[model samples]
Target: MMKKNRLERNSNSYQKQSNVKEVWRRLRKNKGAMVGLVMLVIMAAVLIAAPLFVSYSSAVGQDFSLVLAKPSKEHIFGNDGYGRDIFARIIYGGRTSIGIALLATAASCIVGTILGAMAGYFGRTVDNVIMRSLDIFMSVPDILFTMAVVYALGASFFNLIVALTLAYFTNYVRLVRSEVLTLSEQDYVEASTAGGATSMRIILSHIIPNSIGVIIVNTTMNVAKIILYESTLSFLGLGMPSPQPEWGQMLSESREFMRNAPHLMIFPALAIVITACSINLVGDGLRDSLDPHLKS
Candidate 1:
């Protein structure tokens, strides 16, 4: 009997592993997603090793002789109006842009998830209060609200992140709340509740695990949106300060020289586009993979 049980457990484990492999196989078959994944990997590698290849000061340093230089062997993406190496700046700037997007997304997800889970699991007064407040926040224009927050708080890295998090958290709250509402009706959730599990315990153990798929998909897509919003804010002079090597700040500084040195604008713009597209592609793949109906 013991031997038979061991065999059955082993078989179940193998089956579960095979299912995961199959899901990956399906994801790999998506050409666009795969391409985007590859592009993202390359960009990430470049950004990570940027400092190793070029010092931070050198990237932002000014040299009148190199100002507005065209792409060449010495400077691959050439120099900007400040005579800073565009290639070096791009590599460094990617760190700021990608880092801010990820940090802001994580903050939004954490705050949103907690509030959304509480509202959805409890319902009634809790739901009404949380959802009503979120509704009021959603009513405001996202950009305008972000600008106001940043303006009031004083624009800095921390303030920028807080502003973006506040603006973006509403979507996650709504998404997670709806998911939790549906998940709370599942048999296991009811079983946990009936078994005398504490509300927090049931929410953390039973409710959250089941609702994770939708949450993950939403979080993935939100990264792209956050990056774009960060860039927009930076362009409007409310994002990370100048000389910080942020993509948006680079674009903002280059606007006046657009007629003279279009490469300055083109490279940073291309970086943002590629990053956003890659994230969106990955999000789409995750969505398809997580959908039960789409699973073969």
Candidate 2:
């Protein structure tokens, strides 16, 4: 009986120490966030399931015979200037855009966490050098920096991801740095230090773990911004090369026939807007849920 009671007490203590359940409970109460999550799930499902039903050729294959064809029973969203199905292109394009954004944000988060944790934990010269260098990066406009990198590197999938990763990592560096500064001062951190734990171990094993909640919340919110940046680059002709179905590329191609066929612009624009908005909603919900200070 004593052993069982002790187990129960330990379980309750662990539950109190871990905010995972509490965060989820608060998140579920957010209607906009739930709706956004549903939208994201549907969007992702549609993107994944689409290729199973529609041939890949439909997205890139051109038949001038059907050029500028309006929506019909055969072509749901109608054919593009290249006589490709707009609907099919959008499904594939969404995968590309969202995929790129997710990869860039993830890369940024990893790089940023490492650097930020170092700066915060080491302090003094390490902090000065890291923070000063990041300040130089932050001076440039993200779009212009991304554009220049893409231009110099010559736009391709990998280059775009690299460019975006560089453009975004600074944000996380600052965010995580601030978070780590506080976490580093915690009693556990000092205890670990006094115990002669390696600086790297304490930063990685202790500081980062404590501050991960903030980093994750911020990373979630940054996705929408990265998506917009990618689409903008694609629109300006710096994105994926022609014949590849990117949303912005689709928009660029459709601009010529906007008066005659507005569906071209409408659908792709809607995809970007809806996807970004849904992500933002979920990000907002996460921020609220994780902060703990905010009341429902």
Candidate 3:
């Protein structure tokens, strides 16, 4: 009974400690970042709730009479080339673009983290080959590399995710490998090894947990980059096709109408800009809070 009580007490203490260390605590201290976080959450919520609130069948549905209409009670962001509701299109289209970005970033992080952990924990030839291969991948501009990969694979949502993972995973691998290398050399890691812990156990239990701070920060920043990449792909005609209501596709389609219906370009551009900026602001806050060196 006494041992059971002691164990319960210890478990409660651990939970309390973890709660205290949550990212929000540090994030709250940075008012600007907190505001950005809130804005991002609101944007995501709005996009997710779009289908529930809006009644347009297709994002590109046209009403010739409403073409080039300005913002009003009926059309919040005005009408676009095909006379579709710019506001509705943006809100719904965000779901696709943002979804793609998140999935691609997650794929990159997982693959990169695994490769990096293996290379760093088991150095020598393994490290050399992995790092050298990553170097080759990273040598080219990511956008160009992604384009080449997508061009070869042909552009679909799945292919886009693959291209992004291929293009961006090298960065994650490099960062994670560097962090693992640094952390593995620490005395605690050595101590764990000396105490008969297996290489895998030490890597999972000690190295990975300690290196997660870096990973979290990098992942947050990568989310914004992923969004930008998706937009670029759409702009280049390699992403979602027309009438799909994608932001990049919208920007490309609206370019010609810059002189007449500038609202078409303006609204989509603002969506991409504001969303990316909000993500970056939150990421910056996380980076500063997670890394003691960056904390001010």
Higher-lDDT candidate among 2 and 3?
2
**Model 2's TM-score against the true structure:** 0.94
State the C-alpha lDDT per candidate. 0.89, 0.92, 0.86
Q: What's the CA error at residue 110 for candidate 1, in Å?
A: 1.1
- Quick one: ranking by lDDT, best first? 2, 1, 3
Candidate 1 lDDT (Cα, 0 to 1): 0.89
What's the TM for model 1? Answer: 0.93
Colliding pairs, model 2: none
- lDDT (Cα, 0-100) at 274 in candidate 1: 90
TM-scores, in order shown? 0.93, 0.94, 0.91
Among these predicted structures, which one has the highest lDDT?
A: 2
Per-residue lDDT tens digits for candidate 2, residues 104-199, read 999999999999999988899999999999988999999999999999999899999999999999999998899898988899899989989999
Model 1 Cα lDDT, one tens digit per residue, 1-296: 99998997899789768867876888898888898889889988888888788889867789989989999998999999878999888888889888988999999999999899999999999999999999888988989999999999998989989999999999888888998988899998898889899999998876777778788899999999989998999999998877888999999999999998899999999999999999999889878877879876
- Cα miss at 27, model 3 (Å)? 1.8
Mark the regions of model 1 whose C-alpha exceeds 4 Å error after superposition.
Answer: 1-19
